[model samples]
Structure formats: structure tokens, C-alpha cells
Target chain A: MSATHDATHDEAPIAARVRHVEALLEQRGWLAPGEVDERIDALAAGGSPANGAAIVARAWVDPGFRARLLADANTAIGELGLSMAGGLQEQQLIVVANGPDEHHVVVCTLCSCYPIALLGPSPGWYKSEAYRSRVVREPRAVLREFGLELPASTRITVWDASAESRYMVLPRRPAGTDDLDEGRLAALVTRKGLIGTAAV
Target chain B: MPDRFAAGDRVRTGTVDPPHHTRLPRYARGVCGEVVATAGHHPLADERARGLPSTPRAVYCVRFAAHDLFGEGDHAVVVELFEDYLEPAEREVRR
Candidate 1:
């Protein structure tokens, strides 16, 4: 009898549980009806790598903006109306600049904690256990797998997101694109470049 | 609580493994690193994970040399660590 009951209700247990919780929250007056769906939809709609690319493009064109971004990332992004808000607790944004002699890469060994509002959802590989573990241990080798070959002289700094802060890499502006406008430069930036897995 | 660490201070991560949830990565435990920057105070996640009240503690961006950490690389790794995870280590004269 128990086996039959379990067989009939085992499908989509997680989703069913989520609905149950949402219903409970509504019943308790803690959440409005459809609030969960609305929030999820908002997150999904905001998910895009273009957001990060735009920030990079702006930094490439404006020295003052770049300085501000390096000094304080959350406020700097606000100038463009981008924010890391809307979550339960605000996550801090930390921007690390890539220089001629230095490079930056980010990883979350504990989990796939990233700046979703700024960079959209994280790539699948970034959340994979292999990437989470290997990137911090053998960054150059892992970056080599991504086809990023940095010279021995160029130091690679791996930023591990363990706490509330989220990091984004500001790749050095590529050479020979002097005539490009900010929008064009933004178009030239790639998601991988913003994550420091590849160059712009 | 007042901040116990600042940029440029040498510190060592605690090695004793706790049974509860923690953000301290296993590979980084017992390692010596330098405080590169202060990341601001944050509630101790270990306590919060246990459903206990947690006050904000100082956090730091600690930089560890790849060579020292893994015994063979030339680069470096930086981790955002809570104050409770570190202890002041003797300063080294050379890099």
C-alpha cells in the first residue's frame, strides 16, 4: 500500500514542494499571491551577459568611470542604472582590473556564487564541481583549457568568492580599437572576457 | 566588534576542521597568506547556517602565493575570508 502511494506521488516532488511552500507563504500573508513567480521572472528577465559587457565597454571609454569602478563597484554601476539589489540581502560587487602585468579570474569553490544581476546567470562549467575545485588549484592549466595562455611574467590572481561579495574582471582594453565608440566596444566584449576566462 | 585585521597584515588560516557549515575551503586551511584588503563586515555564515544570531564580523581579501599554497606555481590566489577564520602570523622579511 505504501509502495503504491509513493509511486503515484514521486514525480516532480521538488516542484510540488516549492508550490506547497509558496502556497504556505501566501496563506500566512508573508507573500502576495504569485509573488514568487513574479520575482523569478524578474530574475530571469535580468539575466544577460550584455550587462557585464556594457560595464566593460563604459570603463574602456571613460577613465573617470573606470576609476570609480575600481574604487567602488556597486556605486559605479549605479551610474548606468545597474544594481546588485533585489535579492533578499544585497550582495556586494567587487571589480578587479586586469593590467598589462596582471590578470584576474573568479571562482566560487563552495558554490556558484556570482554577480547574477551584473553578469546574468553563471555558465554551466563555472558551477561544475571540476571547475569549482580545479580553477583555484591549477588556474593556468584550467585557463589553458579555455585557451587563455598568459605569459609566465603576467601574474594570474584567482578571486575566490566565499562570502557576500561578487567579483567581475575588467579585462584590459584590446589594442587597435581606438576608433570604436562605447557601444561598439561593448559589442566587442564577450562573457568569457568579463569572467577573465578569455580576452576581449 | 572592532576589526582585527587590515591590509598588509600576515595571517594564517585555522586548521581545525569544524563539524558545522563554514565558508573556509578545505584546501586553504592552515595556509599562510597576506591581508590584501578589507572586504567589510559580514555576519558569520557558519553561525547563520545553524539558525543562530550572528553579528557582523570583519572580512578580508587574503592573498596566498600559488607556490606556497600548492608547492609549484608562480601565480597567486585571493580569497574573501571572515575574521574568525584567520590568526595573525609572523611577518616575513622577503616575498
Candidate 2:
């Protein structure tokens, strides 16, 4: 057998590793289940991706700042005090904005690898296996399933997040809100806004 | 791992040599691009084999132009890929 195979075989099973970590954390009294759950609930209800939307909104209003964000996402996002963590930290976090001819969608074929730090925990359907396997290969079809129908002429970009790179779609700005300030624009940029639908 | 490619390095999405665990999508294979900026690496998600204790692996962020992957036109899609998913192109042309 190859050295890598031999090594992997000798190593502890993944389940065992999970149990080991759990046991260690439990022993150390660091696994505060109740408190963690509460914290998650609060963060979720507060709107996790809202912060990202606010940044996008400000960029839209300020040409110079928008150049900065388009040039460098991390630094620009950091200026707003958001650090990519959870699954986002390891991957490239790119904000794909919707243009007149194109629309972007995000999915993880293997699992729900998301930019949770910026976008919060994924919605229920996003984590489902049904969405994962079917989205990348059949984006237009799956998007139709989501009740989003685009013209046949519109190009579709299905971002298959498999590795460290995570993606968040930026929906187009809504009409009638052209005069809205950054604060109002931010409020409009909802979670669905980051999902490439429902302009804020 | 820190960023491996500089601003001008040419790269391509590595072929999916299956029978191994990978996060690369099937559609991304063989696409080419010039490195825009290097995004830092994070953990490796080899959960199927490594299980829970598998620590994160270093990854680099590389950006590909929309025209290269799709086709030439006024409308193009830009894409960024993590390092593990890329391979050095046969000819390295600095863009």
C-alpha cells in the first residue's frame, strides 16, 4: 500500500476524532451548549448578512469606496469591522453583484460551506443535500425550483463552493430607492439580497 | 499557506482526478485565468476521509476572468478559486 494510504488507515477514524475532541472539550468544561445555542439564535435573529449588505450599499453610494471594495474585498470588508470566520475564513470571500445580463447563485455540492460569519448560518433549504448536488450542474433548473425564473437570454453563474472559497451574491439595488441614503439602503439589503434575489 | 500566486501568474483549474476527496466542482475543470490577488489559505475540508480531527490546510485565493472561463463578450463572469483547486498552467504568461 502507498505510504499515504497506510498512514490514513493507521490513524484514528474520523468518528473517533470527533468523540475525542468532544471528550476533551467536555473534560475542559468548554462545551457550553446552552449558551452557544442562545448566542447563535441571537446572532441569527439580528440578521447576519445585514452587515455585508450595508457595506455593499455604502459602496454603491461612494464611487471611491466601491473601487476599493472591488479592488480588495478583505480590506474593504475589514474597514467595516467584519472578519470572515466559520467556513469563510479559510476561503476567498467574493461578493458577486448582479448585473443586467448576469445573475449568480451560490451552492456547496459536498455540503453547506457558507460565509456564515458575514451571511450568518445558512437557511434550511441551503443546507439540504437536494440543493447541494443539483444546483451546480443544473443551476437554471434548480433556481426555477426556488421560484426564481430568469430569461433564457440571461447568463447564469453557479458558484460551487467546495474548498475554502465562499461566495455571497449581491442583488441589484431596488428602484424607487435610488434616493435612499446608506442607512436605508443597508436596511433594504436583506439575507435574500445576498442570495441573488430581492433587491434591498 | 500564504498566497502562492502573485498578481500576474497564469493558472488553470486542475483536472478532477477522482477516487479522492475534493471540493472542486466538475464545471470548473480546465478553466484558465491570471492571478488577481492571493487570498489566504484556510482549513482543508477532507471530512470524508480525515474525519473531524482533520485540521485546516493552507489555501490561496486566485481570481479568473469571466471571459476565459465562459466566452468572449461584453458580459463576462469573474471567478476566484482557492489554491488547492488550481494547478500551474503549461505556459506561465504574466498578464
Candidate 3:
């Protein structure tokens, strides 16, 4: 057989590798059986807050700060004392602003890359293979699949986040939110908004 | 080790061999940016990339202009990455 075929045959499946790691961790006493399930449950219960939402709310209330954030996201985020680590540390934070004639969506063509620091661990739908592959190549169509129908005249700016820079979609503030406080504005920012599927 | 770059310092993303652990995205390769801030060290993702033990290393969040990422007229965007994903931005400085 050719070397390529031999290599392919030797490669282990991802699920098996994960299982092996789990077994090794258990054998070494580093992890207890059923601990994985418990940890998963805990993570689910502790839903991460929407960091980008908080930033957007601040921006909507204060135009000057919004300009600063658009100019430099790191400093703007630092103003809020939020640390950038995990996937965020590996990528830049670009807050895409939605306008009357434009909408932005983000995707990682390679994997489920996301701004967990700002938006939290990716939801199940975001991690789906269908979302990753379809979003970058056919954003408008995919948005439709998510039940978001945009105007044909509206321009779609798709942010393909394939590297260390992550993106957060800044949905236009909802009507009647002009007088809302920062806290209330933040509550309106949802993961869907960050993904550019829903407006806050 | 701490970050090799600092806020306001301009740096360029360097190319590294593939099949290596990297926080640098394929799209950001060769892109230039200003070091906006430094994030603390964390377990390296290289271990998972190389099938070895992940080592801890310093990470930083750098900001790149939108024009730099996409072209002119494009608004700016910022990306945070670890030191391992970066190299000296060609122009070395005395730290």
C-alpha cells in the first residue's frame, strides 16, 4: 500500500482518542468516573454572560465610548475589567455594528471558533457542522435557515473568523430601548444578536 | 515568559509550519497589528496540536485595523492571540 493509505489507516478516530484520554485520566486518578458528566452539567448550568452585549449596551448609551470600542476593542473591553483569554486570547475582538442597510454574521470555516470570552461557550447550534460549513459560503441562505430574513437590498457582511481574531455582531438596539439603562440594555443582548441572527 | 510585544507596539504575524498547535488563525497569517494588551499565560494549545503535553505560555490580545484585515473602507477589528502564535514582528526592539 502507498504511504498515504498507510497513514490514513493508522490514524485513530476522534471519538476513540477522546475515549482514550478519558480512560487515561481515570486510570491516573486525575478524573473520576461520572465526573465528566457532572462537570458538563455544571458548565451547562453556569451559562456564561454575554460580554459583547454589555459592550454594545455601553456603546449605544455613549457614542464616544462606542467610537473608542470600534477604534480599539481591547482597551474598551479593559475599561469593563474583562479579561481576554481562551479563544479570545488567540484572536482579536472585532465588534461588527449592524446598520439599517447592513447586517454582519460570523463563522469559523475550520472549526467552531468563537468569542467565548465575550459571548460564552458556543451554543449547540453554532457548533454544528452544518452551521460552520454553510455560514461562510452561503451566509444569506443560512441566515434564512435560522429564520432570519433580511432585505435583498440590505448588504450582508460575513465575517469568516478562521484565526486568532474573533468577532461579535452588534445588533441595532431595539425600538423603545432609547431610555433603557445599561443593565436593561445588556439583558436584551442575546447570543443570537452576536451571531447576527436576531436583533436585540 | 511574558509577551514580546506591548500596547501601541506594531507587530506582524509570522508564518509557522502547519500541523503545529497555534492560536493564530489561517486567515490572520501574515497580518500586521498593534499590540493593544497582554493576557496572562495559559496552557498551550500546541500540545493538543502535536499530540504532546500542553505547556503554559503567555498570551496577548492584539488589535488590527479593519483596513489591514479586509481592505480600505472596512471598519477595524481586534484579535487576541498567544505569544507562541507570534514571532518578533521583523523589527526587533530592546525590551
Q: Evaluated with lDDT, which candidate comes out highest?
A: 1
* Top candidate (DockQ): 1
Q: Model 3, stretches more than 4 Å misplaced? A: A1-47, A86-91, B1-95
Best by TM-score: 1
User: For residues A12-130, what per-residue lDDT tens digits would candidate 2 score against the true structure?
Assistant: 77888767777788678998645556776767654377777778787878877777776666667877776664341233567776778778777776678777767777788888888
RMSD of each: 2.8, 8.1, 7.9
Per-residue lDDT tens digits for candidate 1, residues A86-182, read 5666778899999999999999999899888767889999899999989888888999999999898999999999988999999999899999999
For model 1, chain A alone compared with the true chain A gives a TM-score of 0.87
Task: Give the docking tier of candidate 1.
Answer: high
For every candidate, how close is chain A to the native chain A in TM-score? 0.87, 0.73, 0.76
Where model 1 places Cα greater than 4 Å from the true spot, the runs are: A1-31, B92-95
Q: Quote the lDDT for B73 in model 3.
A: 27
In order, the TM-score of chain B in each prediction is 0.92, 0.60, 0.74
Q: How does model 2 score on DockQ?
A: 0.23
What is the model-wide C-alpha lDDT for candidate 2? 0.65
lDDT of 1 by residue, B1-95 (tens): 68998999999999988999999988788889999989989889999999999999999999999877777788899999999999999865333
Which interface RMSD values do the candidates have, in the order shown?
A: 0.8, 4.9, 6.1
lDDT of 3 at A129: 84
Show pairs that collide, candidate 2: A90-B42, A91-A164, A188-A200, B41-B59, B43-B56, B43-B57, B44-B56, B44-B57, B66-B77
Each model's lDDT? 0.89, 0.65, 0.69
Candidates 2 and 3, the one with greater lDDT: 3
How much is the lDDT of residue A134 in candidate 2? 61
